[model samples]
Target: MSSLTLGFIPLTDCAALVAAEAKGFFAGEGLDVTLSREASWATIRDKVTVGALDAAHMLAPMALAATAGAGGPVAPMIAPLALAVNGAGVTLSNRLSQALPAGAESLQEIAAGLAAFIGQRRAAGEPPLTFAVVFTYSMHNYALRYWLAEAGVDLDRDVRLVVTPPPRMVEQLRTGQVDGVCVGAPWNTVATRGGLGRVALRTSQFWPGGPDKVLGARAEFADDDRLAPLLRALVRAQAWCDVADNRDELAVLLAQPEYVGAAAEAIRPALGEELIFHREGACVPRLEHAQWFLTQMRRWKQVDGDLDAQALIASVYRPALALEALGTTGLGAPVLGNPAPLFDGTTFDAG
Candidate 1:
């Protein structure tokens, strides 16, 4: 049995992969897996492309971007399983949030005000407002772009997009190097708790049930014999993490210095903390949150050219494997195409 090398970035959502290995899920399947933490998404994609990694904990859109050959090193990546979802938010520096009209009453209102604020800053001769995202192909980047464009602001013109790792987002905002950021959990919680930033909007608000992260591998790897058991192990891990009680233990495991490399205290809050949009209050995590991400991918043209959107999503998500591993045929449903009409008045079909 060849050892499987997996790559991941150090973010809270990488918990499932870390816990699966730590809790013996992978070993149980007679596989030796090495989890390597990469510095950036580009490195992760490159390593996977060249076969340096057997699989990876990848951003949903990053995986799509690789398959689509958009703005990154070309690679044939496929996501046959989802690792986690709905763990991201948009964080604005306290100074910026405070300046918004009505002090963050509603996302649409704040977005409008943010556009106006950027205009005022430009008129005053200040540098264009800069926002940081973990990666260009990440859902965070697309979500930020979506919200800004909705407010009539142009991302390329109204602001500069900078790539900042999740762990550094809080400190970067606190020190005034950037105006705001869109990143995954623990970072968002850390920013708010430290009084440096506030949640302007969660990914959920932008599109409920958006896809966040997925277990990705080279397309050739998915066709290999090793894929089934590997995906089965991941399915079991996902089920274990979904249980409310198991989340705390999973959080502790993810917080280990060898895993996320963050203090346990920092990582724990992000796992169970209800969705808290500093101004909108808290709510439970929902599966619908993952769907929104897929919608954004379509909106951003991340899903390769002229491919059937439904087939593209179905090709990547293996609900059958997830169900088989969990021993529940109906436990999960495949999010291949738009199931129902969207609030934004967009319809996706299997063209």
Candidate 2:
């Protein structure tokens, strides 16, 4: 038997990793897995790069950026499996939320209201409003920027973007450290429940079926014999998490102090229709997702302009590994075709 140590952040989407260890899915595959809860995405990246962690629950963009040496150290990584998708939401502090036009319920309306608010702040010569994201390379950052830009807000000129750990998002809001935050579940729900902030919009509203977190491992470990068994265990755990009947138990399990540590009530909402654990080949690390992330990195000037996009995507996203682990006989089709369109009726042009 081979032993591995995996890491995760305290977010609802970390369910599969928590379930794999709690439900003995890892042990069933003859692997002893330890799930370490890390404080930030940077820590997850650094630890995984140094081999302190064998694998981790990582942001889709962070995996690509790490391999390309965009953010921190250049440690090549691969995402053989995706953990979950579309669980992120934008939350504005109650002070900010109330300043918006009343009864503006729809996402576009809320975004427009925010744009108007930013304009008014600018006219009054107020300081540029600040929005926090879990990480610069995270979907939260990209999605938040896309939403604001769609509403005619200049990301670079009209707002200040900052980074905060997922678990600390609510605290930052409560202390008035930030005006808003784009982060994954449990934190958004926790903030709303605490009455410190209001959820302005879910990422799924604009970018349905968007990529979020993945099962990330160092590139050097790809050839290890234990890789197949680990993938099998994670796939099984993801399937287990997708079942509706298991959500209550899964929520309670994740509510433990060692895991997400949020109340089960706050965590349960994310497990609902908004958060997808495994369905529609969700576990497969689709190439289009990587392409979209690369596009965003280049759009924001985070990646080298001369880098080979196709080569980097192919090297970092390995769906063949997932197919190899699950075998061909019963493995369903991969998510090769384009996903559902965004709220504005546009899809990512990964071509």
Candidate 3:
């Protein structure tokens, strides 16, 4: 088989793809994969659109947005599998964290505090609060919007949302260019550890089983019979990474220069249980997170109207393929159904 080249941003969620290639998971499945570290999500999306990349670790909503041509540079993209879920957080600057009312806990409280902060800042002639997120189509943006809206804060008028890369988020917060940021793991932990910020809310709190990252490929590439095995190899890699026993090893692997490029110590806090949240305390992983991400796509109009979004998401995540590759048919129940209240305010029976 020809070696497949995949693109991924240097983030903890990119680990499965990187590990699949490094640990020979792909080779064991009769595939050779080259993992390329992309500089930005836009670059990764463009490369996949133009076929420069066979596959990539993509933002779930971004993949759907590309397919639907909703925004950004239009391209045909599809995810044949989900990679990770609910590993993102909304981090507030240290000042913001300290200003919350006593016993203010949970996203609702943080949102309330943020509203008050914005008011106080404005009353004192300070500038409006500026916030950052990785991408406009990302769940981080949607989740942040949802959380803020729930608190009766108008996202469009009450605050400013800017596009800042994940790597730069902590620095941006530290420098005070932004008051808060919603981004994936390690960055949030990094900000907290550096005493620059505190996690106001974890993505898991808003949408418990939210989709985080996915294995995306060009539509034509996905349709190609030759590439099916490569997709299968990725599914196997996800399963391998999903095992609790492998978490420690995966954390070490992600710390390598070629992967996340962060210190192992920095990456460790995010890989284990006791997921830190400024509002709610740490919690365990929930299997339904991917479904929550799909719901976010629907909420933000990222999915094409022509497709049944839920079904499309289900098809993309091929647990059966992973099971086949792992030769283990019994690995716990399959993740199914809407994990939280649907963004559309509708409900469906999983059966």
List the global CA lDDT of all models.
0.71, 0.88, 0.69
Q: TM-score for all predictions?
A: 0.84, 0.96, 0.83
As a whole number from 0 to 100, the lDDT of residue 162 in candidate 3 is: 96
Model 3 weakest lDDT span, ten residues long: 276-285
Question: Could you give me the TM-score of model 2 versus the true structure?
Answer: 0.96
Q: Determine the C-alpha RMSD for candidate 1 after optimal superposition of all C-alphas.
A: 5.1
Q: What are the runs in model 2 whose C-alpha is more than 4 Å off? A: 328-336, 349-351
lDDT by residue for model 1 over 62-144, one digit each (tens)? Answer: 77667766776557677766676567888889888888987556777888899999989878988888899999778788778
Which digits, one per residue and each the tens of the lDDT, describe model 2 over residues 1-115?
6899999999999998888888988898899888899999999999999999999999989989998999677889999988888899999999999999989998889989999
**Judged by TM-score relative to the true structure, which candidate is superior, 2 or 3?**
2
Ranking by TM-score: 2, 1, 3
Best by TM-score: 2
lDDT, candidate 1, equals: 0.71
How high a TM-score does candidate 1 get?
A: 0.84
Question: In model 1, where do residues sit more than 4 Å from their true spots?
Answer: 272-351
In candidate 3, list every pair of residues with a backbone clash: 209-289
